[model samples]
Target: MSQRSEAGSDAKPGNRLTVVIAQLDFLVGDIPGNARDILEAARSAERVHGADVVVFPELCLTGYPPEDLLLRPSLDLRIQEALDQLMAAELDAAIVIGLPLREKGLLYNGAAVIDKGRITARYFKQFPPNYQVFDEKRYFAEGTEPCVVDIRGVPVGLTVCEDIWSDGPIESAVAAGAKLILNLNASPYDIGKQARRKALLERKAQANGISIVYANLVGGQDELIFDGGSLVVDQYGQVAMEAPQFSEGLYAVDFTHERHCQPVSQPLPEEPSLPHNIYSALVLGVRDYVNKNGFKSVVLGLSGGIDSALTLAIAVDALGADRVRAVMMPFRYTADMSREDASTQAKTMGVQYEVYSIEPMYDAFMQTLAEPFAGTEPDTTEENLQARIRGVILMALSNKFGAMVLTTGNKSEMAVGYSTLYGDMAGGFDALKDVPKTLVFELARYRNEISPVIPDRVISRPPSAELAPGQEDKDSLPDYAVLDQILNLYVERDYSAEAIIAEGYERADVERVTRLVDVNEYKRRQAPLGIRITERGFGKDRRYPITNGWKIGK
Candidate 1:
């Protein structure tokens, strides 16, 4: 075990134990960079706060779910090398960091405690969550034992993300005489998850009679966004320190070990307003997805509708107005109000705006398809042609300017197949892909509450794609309130058609919406990646085969 040059001795009687939880954002696969970040945080904690030990989020080295990269021999070697380099640093405080470990041909999600240039103890993750976005069981072998170590004469227990979700880890640590429990995590964000986490941690602390420190990772990884709400609770289930959500920072707490550590009062930052919290989450999601993948700018089609308006607001907030560009594509059926709303919003947001009429392109397509369309009436076909033309133009801009196109369709439209396939769906990212239409209106109202960025007409007017003359969203799909309710049950809550009908929904409506959702799996498969705020999002969490024969009533 690693031993540090004694900084003298343990805490004196009635002395306080200083602990810091480093809520950091780590880029996946960036081992050297992450290691440097870990070291920097450790140094800061030791020098600035005089902390006895510092803890970081789970999988801080390789980032969370290094996915298949954990299987690569070279990556594993690099992780070990990074840990060695971290151990080589001379620091007074013991540091606990998370990484993956491969032992005897079995991989485990592990955390290591380092002090005086040596690893004192290593704890492998006991639970590998396999449901939803987690697939740890596919790659990791569950650890059977808990790790307990000494820091300045205080017995400390170590557990990875999933270990603390149950009673075993905490029970084992308390049974082993641990006075404090440090839980490392890479927990992803879902609406209302923060409250759930706090309740669980409080219960664990109260039950075990030990002060518990919880640290979680922050930032967007692919479709998953982690809101770092790292926190600390004392033996009596009182919160001592709480970090802000959706940002990276270090939070410190002082624990005095007597017969038990009584909770100390510390002024914590106020919880962010709901709109601010959700908006920040969306912005972070977009920024990380673009910057991490090396994109310079973003492009999106701006209809005179609320969906596109809100999407533009999010893009400008994420990538800055200078980095965002909007295109106005007016079709034959487009209204003058839409044109005005689109232009006004663009100018208001200070983004580069351009006008591109798809009439010329529509004429060209009609001429090309005239022979095959012999005697057929141009109905939805002509409307769809306009959408495709706009899509092609936006994609061209994306290619020429090196900007990714952002799609603006919401969950309600997506569920009812009200959106065009290659038209509105063609983009590198979808900002509102998981957000429903009702929530879209709520967000627009919330944005306006902050400042009058979106035009009043944009929020007040009925939503329409203007694909056909006098087209409104309700022309094909049901009203958003009803649609969203049906979808929340059918899609988000995973209710069957019969179950939805039993909940007072008309049988026909339930069947129509559910069938549309099932049929549109192909479209969702082709859609761009988006942030996941709900329990089950379209990306990795809800996996349905594209070509499947399963029917609801059959």
Candidate 2:
């Protein structure tokens, strides 16, 4: 493939600058499909939106975190073939698509600038983020030089996700005489991250004295949920256009680039509130995980608990109630209110549901264990048996119906090993695996606001597993508020137990939570893949070995 430039001197300044931000969900390692999606998006931008330029998310061709697949020599050739196909398309608009590039014996996380059947320019990402869910340093060699290419009289500066998060890339772009900055991103979703992104973009635009168009990828890839909160900010630090978070769409914004002296008058679209934002993240995460992985429907055990209720609500909202099935697995110690809440929530969500009582199975297991445990007093062993039974039934239904089982355990439970492996953890996907228990309540309230689908009693009552008689979550663990705080420090912030204690945490509470987290590494290893709404999630971010001897205080 020959590279050519369409550089022209002193092109006329056009008043209407149309930029299309393609908020797409690209599958990992699906090069052909991803290329097709990009071409289709480009066609849509040119034919439908009349856009002069279209921008895609970072690494849209090979997906983000191709992991060790970058080691394969053939992957780069495949991406090049895809890029060639895209460049050969008949679309008139300039296309900026992310793909890996091999230049001078080093691989680069790069984006190609294609216009009118030719590759004009390429921008390599400078900051290859290595911390917290990113391992770019492991694959691609970082680029030091900034790229600012001229596209149809508009000087466009190109940068990837992490580049704009810092100062150097954006500053270099402005220094290189770029009028507009196009930032491609695959930023994963976390609580309050959307707001932080907007704030940073606003600052970047104001500081650089250029309009910035931020495009982020949307979907769940294993654990990572990339919330597509793409937006355009003017030089005066004002938002011109904002795209919806956690949904896929082609959004266009017209920027008047003729010597901007006054503030841009484009109406700023309203962004979703915090609770709604979190809810949408969960919904998109569940929806993408189910649909992308070829699952027709989802099956989850409805325990009349808050975690399951929230997970069910998210699943139904994402895949619709018709595709979501809830099963009530009642046991010996299960309360009537628990059953009633589960049934009511399922009915309110309009999902298909069935009652599967586990009393008989519980009795059989107990009878079998009676001979071996006759002398010992029954503790959590009996309680865990009921949970395991419920897990078995859910998995059985999943196998029978070809549906994916959605585990409802929250991050707090998963973090502290409060959940049972081969029981509640026996599912293909976990909907709320990254969401802490405190945020779970906030999401429940948010769900009720849209339509009071989840029963108020489910949200109001204290969360309980009901594995044993009169059991509550607090009986085994600390309050969710305190627990989440400690977890945020330990997991997200990477604070030590002594550091957490120094930051006003009770020594005993910190010790207990840290110990649980350390001892439960084996269980987390067996947990299902879920949407990553946090900086540190179980599958990728937290990778502690099960047989480690490193104690917290030691």
Candidate 3:
């Protein structure tokens, strides 16, 4: 489990305290299964490492962000049963775990310290975050107190996820004579989130003059990815021990108390590159989504474009090449290089590859719509027919063989409604929904650095939908370098058109891009959900009225 030497039974409890961090993943709403894992981890922490206390992530019993499941009437009963099961094990070490606690008819996000077949202390979360993918205020009432307990002659304080982010709870615990504080969390991963957490912990521990232990959950929960970079910080705000990110395991730390307290030395993990962090998050997201949802395999339309090529690479990396299938749906508009690149990449990745020409399907659809389109001239309707044909063919394959269809649309296209609904957007999941066009190029290069699966030409070619002859994306959209900057200002930061234009952008470009983002709300509403990497993705992080008439001005 942990990499620490065993502190045998002869170790004195008065001078030494062994606290193990259980940085593991748990399924949401699987209370029984989660409890079993918690119990097993607790026992191993005590028996193998001789731990005095073992800390688990927030909501480890019922999982984090249970959403509407917390409103169920049986939620209280299930939580109680899980806690009772943990206590019945009668472990020698104190187990600090999190759950939704109900008291006097009000539910609170709380944690309990169970030791010697009883709950020694209970702590409720003081601050419940309500912004950006967190809706705890709707489900949990705020707790206004601090809880401190004694374990192995050390006065340890307890705090939930949001409580540690603020100063009041830790101050109260310190005032109550606590030497060490343990925080349980289910914090999700975003770009630069780990750095922010380390900074926050260092500042808080130094400010309070107390050592802190942070235990975080690891795995994918729908659109959220928990990276599990749990760690221990000394009273002087120095990182004492650090756990690996995007991994699941038990890590141990020892604390010796004299006049003050500090964690024993442990090797710190090397920081991963930015591309590595993002790629790992995507891989974990796809792997858990596929396995947990019971999908046998995944299939996608493999155009030689950068977006689809990246999606194919992620699918193959997430699930093995055998569990991934790539289909090249060619039409009259499809280029020879597109076909060649798709075939070359699929062959390099060693996945199941097939060719399905949409020419017959397009012809059949046109023949059926001839009478209804009597007065219509050829336009995007004709172009969209090719895309719809490819969508239908991919769906048919998914229906016949039971492989989940993965869509390939990046955020730059999604923000401007450059994508066609029920066409390229017709799939179950999208791994790059929050990624921008520029980031897609960077990730492709990063993957190739690991192994040269994607052909060099694919990365160097101009991006195009190829629904019509020479249909490059630049025809309808602004330069991605400009569009992504405006999007970050408008969609993520909520900047007005006038304000964005004032930021050195042209007025016409600002107006047009923001208008597309507004008018396309209905389309994005119908698109499949995907992984969230930015501060604000088009998922729960950003919610706008699809039918509103709000003007885009400062």
Candidate 4:
């Protein structure tokens, strides 16, 4: 979803000119619609915020990480059309907007400073991120020139997203006589990313002794979610103002030659709690993926577990109760409380829900498999039949309706192959695929803070698959708190078993968990894509060879 609206009071702190930060979300590849949003926000910044200059996020016109869309033949033409529209608008304030510039058979990620129906200055992004989910080098040439545009007689430096992450661009702009720097960003969300950005920007502000105004894009694009934690840091390394996370708006910072930047006592946004940040990221990710892809609604199995409960709440909050469907498929060992809790939560959220017992289906599958297992002891193969039965029921509902099926497995189960393949994992998307099991419970509590949707008993009860009599998660796996930490160290940080053990974890548990993760690569590869809230998610950030024979220790 793009920005809803961003009209806030314009600050006029006497000494400096007011520069508005257009903290808005832009839809990827929607050139025409994105152009309209840019124009509307530019005009509003000047008219409502009384901004002398309004700064938008990186690639505001074309959207960030446009990926292969940059390879399209008509991209250059669309960009030129957008620039022409901006020039034609004759915006009152000097508007800074990011776009891709194609010239002389070379394309550069650029930010244009427009004033008086003309392009006053242009700054190409000095650094193009090429790691992790970024592949900017594929479409853009490296920019070495420094850009400092004169806004109301003050020289303001311009830098794109990755440019500020590095040293050269900001330093180059400072050398080019910029008293203030306006950095535009489309940085994707990860746990602790906002803190890192804030600290880095503050240090840059103090080192350069230039007031920095940052504008960031907010919303979701496919698997990534960009949180709008835009900042305004004074020359003294003090935070003057900061926009709230998961919100879009036009925020302003006043600046002048006399004071460098006009000072204010604006209260800094409180640090977002872990639940708040991750939950917000997931909601935005689901909302955009669903709406942007033009899906009518979504459906999922409601197992009365913490993972599905959180997923259901997130889906309802994102698309509303009308667009979500909950299905409960119970087999022989399925508990009555599971059904009761699923019904209670579904009714509380006012979602369309149904219960279809999978007893007949399970029986049919068992009868077919009885011959194959005639001489073998019963194992996980039989237990997996139950989950596969439920998966079929949920998918059938999704097919009957047009709703997409949402798989409800968390990162912990995904890491060690604790989930059944094509059974519980059969779906269009996984809401908690990046989230650890420990965090899932936290999110359930977080959602309840807004309103009491999840039953208290659900939260307090010990988690179980209910696939067999007296089944519990801890019976087959280590405690979640212990497992999640080990998973994070190994999967996210690439820590070796020895290193994890040195950190006080038992050698046996570390070796066992890491072994499971390495062996289960094939399963995770088949799982549906989900929201990425951590630094390293399984799909994009972490890649492993499934056929490897590497072991933790001799």
lDDT of 1 by residue, 1-554 (tens): 22122233477456677888899989999999999999999999988888788999999999886899888769778987998899889888888999988878888999888887888888888888998899999889998777778777777888888888876978887777778889999999887888889898889898888888999999999888999989888887878888889888877788887787554658877877766777778888999998998999999999889999999999998889999999999987889998998999999999999998988888888889999999998787777778888889999999998999999988787666777879888888887888889989988888888778898998988888888878788878778899899999988888888988889998888888889999988888888788888888887788888799988733
- Stretches of candidate 2 off by over 4 Å are 1-14, 260-265
Among these predictions, the greatest lDDT belongs to 3
Please provide, for model 4 over 145-235, each residue's C-alpha lDDT reduced to its tens digit, 9 standing for 90 to 100. Answer: 8887767767778899898889888888888777788898999999999889989998999998888888899988877889998988888
What stretches of model 4 exceed 4 Å from their correct place?
1-15, 263-265
Candidate 2 lDDT (Cα, whole model)? 0.86
lDDT of the structure predicted as candidate 3: 0.89
TM-score, one value per model = 0.96, 0.94, 0.96, 0.94
Predictions: Cα RMSD each: 2.3, 2.6, 3.7, 4.5
lDDT of 3 by residue, 1-554 (tens): 10111122333556878999999999999999999999999988888898888999999998877999998889888988988898899799889999988878888898888888887777778899999999999998998877777777777878888888886988898887788999999999999999999999999999999999999999988889898999899999999998988889889999998777789978788899999999999998888888878899999999988999999999999999999999999999899999999999999999999998988888888899999999989998988778788889889989999999999999998999988888999989999999999999999999999999899999998889988788888888888888899999999999999999999999989999999999999999999889988889997998899998688876
Clashes of each: 0, 0, 0, 2
Report clash pairs, candidate 1: none
- Between candidates 2 and 3, the one scoring higher on TM-score is 3
Report every candidate's CA lDDT: 0.85, 0.86, 0.89, 0.86
Q: What lDDT would candidate 4 get against the real structure? A: 0.86
Q: Give residue 292's error in model 4 in angstroms.
A: 1.2
